[model samples]
Target: MLVGNRVILVTGAARGIGQATAVFLAASGAQVIIHGRSEESMDETVRLIQSAEGLEPLRVAYDVRDEAGMKLAFKQIKKIFGRLDGLVNNAGIMTEGLMGMVKTTHIQEMLDVNVTSVILHMQLSSRLMLKNKQGSIVNVSSIIGTRGSEGSAAYAASKAAVIGATLSASKEWAGKGVRVNAVAPGFIETDLTAHYMENKKEKLLETIKMNRFGHVEEVASVISFLLSDMSSYITGQVIGVDGGMVI
Candidate 1:
């Protein structure tokens, strides 16, 4: 109940880690907002949350890279919730290819989704959060961002940028009671990573010290902690849910 009555928005929440986070946040008593690129996706997420006895999270849709869409989404948020207490910038995309072989458009798309959209969300969300003079934000980063990986150059760069943004935002807003941090997940089992699980299953397992892929709930728990008062003193940190891969 740490987040009871708190208004929290989770983007890219139609499925996968985003959906798990939304469910956890709602279960923790937040007035959760579920966002996705389509209504069908958000609807499914809402059903899942409701089935779990969690609050019926608001369903919002937006193209992460579109500034206008984000603005309108926030407008709707204010109208419904009146204030924003927490935000999870979990919306992102991954395009795998060799650094040299990756097209310019592909890299740009990755940056636009994983990095630029995050900044835009922070800007729009922070304005509402700052009004209350207290808020928390959790950016979903990736292990690739810190350690690098084959065929993930652009994705790595984008996630790395997320860490940098989290750091800077924490410093810039901490004094005003806003905390920003990030969770760097490693080899999570989600639709996004289904291809990897299929194509590089054993090799990926070998790399994980835990000898297993992470569950979305594991990462979601950490995110909930970071967004709650439990981690009030923590900010500008990139905590890895990577099963000791870094070790």
Candidate 2:
């Protein structure tokens, strides 16, 4: 799918699926704005896009949980790009813990980073998009959010909340020319899932219908499609990039 020079912002673009998405979108011709916790963290992503001969991407760094930083980042987008055409809410943290042993602090942190920040970014993005009367939003949720997992209760909860927001926001914005959707990815081979892969690779492989973990580019391609006109008539849906793990 072609993004055709659309200005898009990808959060947590320093690594993993987020980084891959930024690179993929740039390759697809989208003018990407890559965000990370710090500018240094996004170096590799920047290099990858540049190496691919993609347009120079705007780099913005700030913790997703920082409200002021988030607002300022959007402001920068407006000042530089004049308008935002798409957003990928991919910045999030995964904290694994079982029921009773899970730390309250950890749960709260997940909520702030995964759920709250997503909502806020959508709000900010929609405002800019609405100004032009068009935009698309793609949220990166997790399969654990839809099907649940043994030790990822908090992370699941936060991701599930993202699904909820995606649905609600889609309904609220679709009539105004903006669309919102989510992708629930199953175990993906990324730094984020390295621990799980190391400890439960065999069992997880047996559970996956494809008998393998997903690749970052696989998820990135889906995110790009969602942000492009190829998915023009789609919204409020959570597409599973799970290799049939959810089924």
Candidate 3:
């Protein structure tokens, strides 16, 4: 019960790590705002979380990149919860190809979804958190953000930006008592990575020292720690839940 009375907003909460984190937080007694792009997916996640013995999180649907829609959703959040204690920026997209071969639109879309939206959400959420003098912001970065990988320049770049943002924001807001941190997860067995590792299993395994893909719960546990008082003195840090891959 790390988040006994907190209100949290998790983006991309329909499935994969986002869904897992929402359930993890809810089970710990957080009032979670399960956000996703589709209403059906959000509803399913709500049901799944409740069935798992977690609290019934509020289902909210909004594309992270939709500024107008995001603003409206925030207004609704203020009206409903009156306050927010944490935020998990888990919504992201990957665009992979030779850097030069990637189209302009592809690059822009990835940047908008993965980088720009995160900054916007942090800015908005920070305003709400500042009032309380206590809040946690966890941005889901990737191990690739620190290590350059072939054919994933855009994705890596966006994640790298997330790390940069986390560090800067954490420092700037530390005095105000709002902790900002990032979780750089390694290759995890989730739907997002299925497309990349479908047939390149051997190559992916060769890169990891553990030689095994990580589970969603492994990442969620670290996130829960960050959101809890257990990590009171930690901020501006990138906790890599990567099975010792980059250590």
Q: Quick one: best TM-score, which candidate?
A: 2
Roughly what TM-score does model 3 have, to 2 decimal places?
Answer: 0.96
Top-down TM-score ranking: 2, 1, 3
Candidates 2 and 3: which is better by lDDT? Answer: 2
Clashes of each: 0, 0, 0
lDDT of 2 by residue, 56-123 (tens): 99999998888999999999999998999999999999888789889999999999999999999999
lDDT accuracy of residue 117 in candidate 3: 96
Off by over 4 Å in 2: 197-199
What lDDT does the true structure give each of the candidates? 0.90, 0.93, 0.89
Estimate the lDDT of model 3: 0.89
Q: Which is the winner by lDDT between candidate 1 and candidate 2?
A: 2
Taking the tens digit of each residue's C-alpha lDDT, what string does model 1 give over 32-83?
9889998887887888788778877788887998889889999999998889
Stretches of candidate 3 exceeding 4 Å from the true structure: 197-199
Among all candidates shown, the one with the greatest lDDT: 2
